[model samples]
Target: MIVQVALATGFVLILIGIYGALTQRNLLRMIVAFTVANSGVNLVIVAVGYLPGRTAPILDATVPAAEAAARIIDPVPQALVLTAIVIGLGVTALMLAFAYKLYEKRRSLDIARFSELKW
Candidate 1:
């Protein structure tokens, strides 16, 4: 029940982020939208990997080694999400830095203001 809700919410967030990114002209707004979309992706991945009523992928007294596979949740998605989060943060920081530099050069964050590459 909760998993479905989370998956749905994540999809909604992804859609909203994509819409915001497409419609907003400001560099900052676009960065924010990308971040939101990244978060949604992470959430969706985590939600998909989640197993209801299951424990972490660790073996202990509560879970024997033989039954560990059945009792533990898959760890690949969690690890992938963690790596994605770190990469996303770095990308966001780079984007913000580039935006700041552009803003400093033009005194504006509007996408239309910088058209030097447009042909």
Candidate 2:
């Protein structure tokens, strides 16, 4: 029930972000929407990899090594999501930097105003 809700929320966020990114002509707004979409994707990945009633992949006195595989949740997706989050941050920073440079160059944030730069 909770997992379903999370998945639905993630999908909804993705759709909303995509819509915002596509419809907005402002560079900053589009970057913000892409970040929202990226977050939604990360949520979906985590939700899909989540296993109910499972513990983290840690072996202690209570959790024996032999039963670790069956008792613990998969860690791969979590790790991937962590890495993706860092990469996403870097990408967002780059996009912001580009936006700043473009603004400084043209004094405008509207993407349509920069169409002449197209090759």
Candidate 3:
């Protein structure tokens, strides 16, 4: 039940982010919406790794043998998410830089005013 709710909530967040990104004009807000979408996806992925009848993956000898035998959550996805987070930081930095340049070029943050390529 918890996992299902998490998945549903994540999907809703993704939808909201998509809508905001499509309809909003401010560059920074669009970036923030993208970040929200990314978070939703990450949450879904993490939720998928959760096991209801399983114990934590910590390898203490005190853990019961049967619980330890239950297939552990795949670590690869978690590692991938860590790498993605780092990459996302870079993407945000780049997007912020472009936003700053846009502000400098037009002295405004409105996206509608920069429709032309030459300006």
Superposed Cα deviation of residue 41, candidate 2 (Å): 0.3
Query: Least lDDT summed over 10 consecutive residues: which range in candidate 2?
Result: 54-63
| 13-39: candidate 3 lDDT, tens digit per residue | 899999999999888899999999988
| lDDT, candidate 2, 16-57, per-residue tens | 999999999999999999999999999999888889888876
What stretches of model 1 exceed 4 Å from their correct place? none
Model 1, residue 78: C-alpha shift (Å): 0.6
Evaluate candidate 2 by giving its C-alpha RMSD to the native, one decimal. 1.8
| lDDT values for all models | 0.94, 0.94, 0.82
Checking candidate 2 for backbone clashes, the offending pairs are none
Positional deviation of residue 31's Cα in model 1 after best superposition, in angstroms:
0.7
Weakest 10 consecutive residues of candidate 1 by summed lDDT: 51-60
Which has the higher TM-score value, candidate number 2 or candidate number 3? 2
Model 2 spans > 4 angstroms off: 117-119
> Could you tell me how far off, in angstroms, the CA of residue 46 lies in candidate 1 after the best superposition?
0.9
